[model samples]
Target chain A: MADREWSTVDVEDIAALTAVYGGNPARWPADRRAAAVRALAMDGAAHELVVNEARLDALLSMVAEPEISAARVDSVVAGALARLDAVTAPAAAKAAPHKLDTFLPSPFDLVRTALSWLSVRAPQAGWLAGATVAGILVGVMTMPSATLSGAETTTAQAGTAVETAQADVTDMPSLLFTSYTVETHAR
Target chain B: MDESVQPQPRVGTASASAAAPYAGNPAGTLMGLGPEPGDDALLARIAQGDRQAFALLAARHAPKAMKLAQRVLGNAADADEVVQEAMLRVWTGAKNWIPDGRARFSTWLHRVVVNLCVDRRRRPAFAGLDGIPEPPDPTPSAVNVMARQQTAKLVSQALAELPERQRLAVTLCYYEERSAADAAQILSLSVSAVESLLARARRALRARLSGVVQDTGEV
Candidate 1:
């Protein structure tokens, strides 16, 4: 092994060696190919260490090849089919519309469909602006005051007390909305 | 969760009429049970509501998927669960299966299995822990199983001794049978980074397992 040209080894060459023996031991370079192996493992004592590691790696690859039982395959298939059946049958049953399905549109879906309809049936720009103003005015007109009238004061206090009693439900966000685009240039 | 609503396959002998007509095709055994009729065929059948075809597809791919999961998780039970979850995702994604496009069914399944395993590995349950106590030697557990298993266990043990990235590099290469390029893709590491990991892992295994076998060659 003396006079062996280990000088030819480089880090990229070492990388190539690892690539060859790294996953596939079948193609591992010969044991006497120490110079190449040394280069692969960064030379020095690492050369020998890598050789031994490769041998151990070969052993471990043998162990990883599990002997799967045919019976296990059958059990797995049956179990899968059972699981599939469990999931799919309910879905098939649910294909028929329920009472809630008939009456309650999915909120997001309803919003999407309404948006599409509005896009199709959008009014003239002037009408749209007038409608937006009118709707805003109506919303402001219908707004309930926290400050109550003389007779409404007692009722308002009682309502406030009842709402405070149910604290968990009080802070929930309301889902109601109507959208209107603001036209800066037109305004 | 509704047990009663689940499809109940009639147990016992099948009626000639009830058996799916496509079940016994000569090509069935030749395909060695891949997801039914390959991606294109399965996608077509699924579009037509052929649940049996979908079942065949799932049954076909489940084993290899489970094996991949097993390799990643290093536990058979967890592997089984991962396969179940992965197959469920496949079934649910059937409508979106693109038969003629860039999506290869095997690649999709592999991605699903890998993602699920990775997710589970990140969970508190499987995050870094001391090596599981080696099982009772098979009278010869680590040594006699075949050089590959011994190499794998040594490598795995050594890898377990490593920082996470190095261990992942080693496991993906040795246990999962991945090429360095493929491992780099899976781990999102550069090819050079992957090489460094493998080198580190090999050095660790060598240091840990050297001289473990004594004269007369006993472990």
Candidate 2:
């Protein structure tokens, strides 16, 4: 095999041959081929030869096969973007500066502001008068019912009267029993 | 090879170079389309809450990532999943993407995709070429269909048989046309290590493709 009048093969030759047989031979001029052959000869067994061949075929197949559909590429990118969007959504949401809703005053603050306005715009007596009226309204709404109170007092008095009547009856019975016993003993 | 060539943060060119739709202008590459700024800048803008910039970054790099994923996993569907996951990682990390100016953003992106692909390729479902999708056979057009299919099958089979490192090394060099040094950086291997790996891979590939590569004209 060594005797076959070897024109030195090199990595460049492999590359040129790769270009040539891969169906783009025009890219490798003879000089380029010669240079490649020289490189391949010098660099033989240095890289994965079979794998390179396979890769060359794959590359050729890629070129031979029409460019991958643009739609395919679009879909892939769109899909990736969507995924990224989903993954980053929380972080993005958090990173945004506080919104208008965040700046709105609380209920307490609103009430305080209203009181301040009333104090400054109205006469001091008028503001105090309004506060007193508000306080009276709250007190009236929370007041106990007069009917309920009267009913409770009546029930207590009735209970005491009933107990007094029962005590009188119990004393009469005891007094009668004692008098009968003493009179019988004397007879 | 210059030591002064600061590592330019070699980001993946994925979302930044999206290919334009066929009906559109010639302006876009596969992932490098639309309004997304370059990767490093987009990363900066994204950190600053720029949704448009983030979208652009995703558009530019996803295609290349998908393609690399497909090669590693041997199935388009799985590759798609891997790319999606890889981009999700990029989105999360963008806030910290302080550019060191040593490598391109695309290069960094390439590494990310490669790592994801490698991880996914190790799964049981990706065991062999059996799961890889083959091109649909067209009506026989005197195209030597059998021969081409056989050649393609042999090539893919041989590729599948290479050690993962060798396979990746060859892929970056021959398929992607990356320089050895670039491949080394992507694989995180030293240049000499890549060279050695390539040497072994090429030898193995030569043995496997001897008959096919020879007869098919210089493959």
Q: Where does the lowest 10-residue lDDT sum fall in candidate 2 chain A?
A: A144-153
Error of 1 at A117 (Å): 37
lDDT per residue, candidate 2, B116-182, as tens digits?
8887766666445646566766767736876666777677788789999988986776566566667
lDDT of 1 by residue, B87-129 (tens): 7666566666766654456557766877888888788775333
Q: Please give the TM-score for the first chain of candidate 1.
A: 0.29
Error of 1 at A147 (Å): 23
Task: Report interface Cα RMSD per prediction.
Answer: 8.0, 7.7
- Native interface contacts retained, candidate 1: 0.14
Candidate 2: regions farther than 4 A off = A1-68, A85-187, B1-36, B126-143, B213-219
Question: What are the per-residue Cα lDDT tens digits for candidate 1 across A1-187?
Answer: 2224555655545445654345333333344255564455555544544454456555445444443443444455555555665554333433655566677778767756765666567746445655665665666565333222232335555555434333322221210111111111112
Q: Interface RMSD (Å) of model 2?
A: 7.7
* lDDT, residue B36, candidate 2: 26
Q: Could you say which candidate leads in lDDT?
A: 2
* TM-scores vs. true structure, each candidate: 0.52, 0.53
